[model samples]
Target: MTLDAALPALSSLLGDRLCRSKSELDHHGQSESHFPPTPPEAVAYPETTEEVAALVKICANHGVPVIGWGAGTSLEGHALAVQGGIVVDFARMDRIIAVNAEDMDVRVQPGITREALNEALRATGLFFPVDPGANASIGGMASTRASGTTAVRYGTMRDNVMGLEVVLADGRVIRTGTRARKSSSGYDLTGLFVGAEGTLGLITELTLKLRGQPSAISAAVCAFGEMDRAVAAVIETIQSGVPMARIEFVDAATARAVNAYSGADFPEKPHLLVEFHGSEIGVGEDAEIFRAIAEDNGAEGFEWARQTEDRTRLWKMRHEAYRAILASRPGARAIVTDVCVPISALAQAVSETQADIEASPVEAPILGHVGDGNFHAILLIDPDDTAEVHAAETLSARMAQRALRLGGTVTGEHGIGMGKLGYMAAEHGEGWQVMGSIKAALDPGNIMNPGKLVPPNNGAVG
Candidate 1:
């Protein structure tokens, strides 16, 4: 498919909906993380499911690649159209179809952001709990299976997304799962597509599970003398079964970086920022149990944020921790990779990773949703320095392999976009090949987002 030839037909089909301007292409090409800008031939804004289906159909006829674009917050280049096709920007599809407060679910367009949905649910005493800190579109979140601090209790996109309206590569519209809860159902296609990274189909609409706002919420930070102690505290808390709403780990370096950037001061040491949400008594009990665990692990310098405003400020700072890290080092890009392991192996993993980082030249900051055994090392890089980029990638790859050895995944929430595609075979082995077969079945022409997720016929795509 000569991409230039397809663009004229795409423009004809989409009319003003098609974008090919330099600025628009540049904007769509870029990503939040360190991947180099790779733009598509054009960007398409589809307002409705039928619009998306029609767009896909046109692309299919021309053997043109189609990439799904959401809020463009993907850290792993999942939204980037590297092969140069039509980028279906879903921003114009922002709308809430229905909000069933009693059913505890909402029907929304792919572009409806998590923050917007929460705002609508404000008076209803219910909120969607999947907070990736980016205010990512619900569709994008589902595509990448993003989970943030609150995932310990509320679950990831895989759990919250009850159903999805997807346009197949050939423009066939299919609805997977249902608004009603749990179904033995058929082949579990919904699970397959939730984290497919848009290689199989374009997610147009989503039915999301909602959580009731807890009656009593408490947020606090506990600092430990050492990273080992802080990690131990997390393990103990989880093992003791407090059902933590959010439990995050920030290494001393990360704490210093975020504090410098966010202007929140504390003793610069390994720390845990935790939240408890439940009935008044239940939250109190969970906090008590957590306090005991922290003290046992030699945690000190504990600070409590009791008021709602104070709690929000605390969490907001934590969410912006990534920005803070980038600010600490002027003129540096980041290579961020997420890996999750068994809870029992978290301490070893963190210790080994910290050691590896300290031994390396790259300035790496460690942080994670510790309760879920998921963490990331944000390796600061100088884009102009090829050596620095390679070093950072080496560190990320080593840690990913280590996580797999511990019976973990290369990416816990961040889906296998372009970056982690290499590790798919190592993590899934034969099952990874099975995934490619599924992709072949769904997208025979490979007209969907190319150079991502599934491998080629014989071996790895890379």
Candidate 2:
């Protein structure tokens, strides 16, 4: 199994579509997060599923690694080509195949970004609701089982992705699920592959469930006296069954960072940015109820953005929170921590996490979709300072342990790429081994995506 042998066949098949230039290789190698660049030997741009199948067959023959690339926005180094092989970049395969407005679904190629899909669907009065803050590609979102602020209401990629056209490890194409919603047929292969993180196969197409555009949309930002109060408000809101469309939490440090980066005025206190979608009257009633709950939890400085421009500005600032946090510390890289606990345990979880960050030597800002008991602490550290990096790693490990201790998950949305592999055993134990067994069954050669989301094996070439 050698990349040298595979490149000749790939070049013969793709011609100029197969890229070996250093610039393209370096571009495909870079990650958005802190992982150092690990470039692939070559990058192949396949425009069709048949081409993808043929590419995989060629790689399988040579026993070379194949990694899929979408928009390259993943945080945990999900698409990095650590092993030197051919990276199947999906940039050319981006196309919205069909939109079945009557069925409230859309069939799309794997490379189309979420923003593009929504833009295409705007005229139909339907939209895909699984927004992960980033304009991430639908394929990448499904691969990660991603969910964000709207997931508290519309659910995650696991719920929105109705069907998938996947290319198996050995170049076979198969479709899972149907346009119709309900199914009792066979194993839930769609669900299995949704969060597999490319260890099993590569997703080529997706049929995503869409929701109707709401009549009235309302967004607001409310500040609390303390972090616990903001978290408590979220718990009470969920327990009260308010049906919130979105509810995100950001600590004081995060708010300050956003203020500095986005040029917006925000109180330097723990805040909950929330949104509601429904009929005009219904949305108003829900906001009233949420306001009452927040007030009960000692929330103050409540401000609503009722106009369309105001709402867009508010959410835009919230989506840019990660960059804002990074901007807080110049020349600092981040190790993002994603953890989710039961709604009832959220207050204690955030409290302990805030206390830990306070004690740490590095700056770690807390934020996330708290309505679903999911949150992140972006741990910033000087890349050159080994001691600072170690401190940040220790904080991340403790956060993972705390999430498990609180009966939650080590990863809420970010899958086990290269970052969170160590916590898999602690989180899933025997089940983790079962995942490896399934991987072996689907991809015996381990060429799909080596050294990710499964147990270690000799076939790993990275």
lDDT of 2 by residue, 53-153 (tens): 99999998888889998888778888887767778888888899999999999999998999999999999999999989898888888999999989999
Q: Give TM-scores for every candidate, taking all chains together and pairing residue i with residue i.
A: 0.97, 0.98
TM-score of 1: 0.97
Per-prediction RMSD in angstroms?
A: 1.7, 1.2
Q: What is candidate 1's lDDT per residue for 1-462, written digit by digit as tens?
A: 666766666677678988889999999999987889998888898888888898888888778889998899788898888777889999999999998999999899989899998998899999999998888998999999889999999999998998889999888999999887878868888888898999889999898899899999998998989999999999989998888999999999888988898888968898899999999999988898899889988988788887999999998988898999999999898888799999999999999999999888899999999999999999999999988888898899899999999999999888878888899898888998898888887788887888888785433221
On lDDT, the leading prediction is: 2
lDDT of 1 at 238: 94
Question: Against the unseen true structure, what C-alpha lDDT does each candidate score?
Answer: 0.89, 0.91
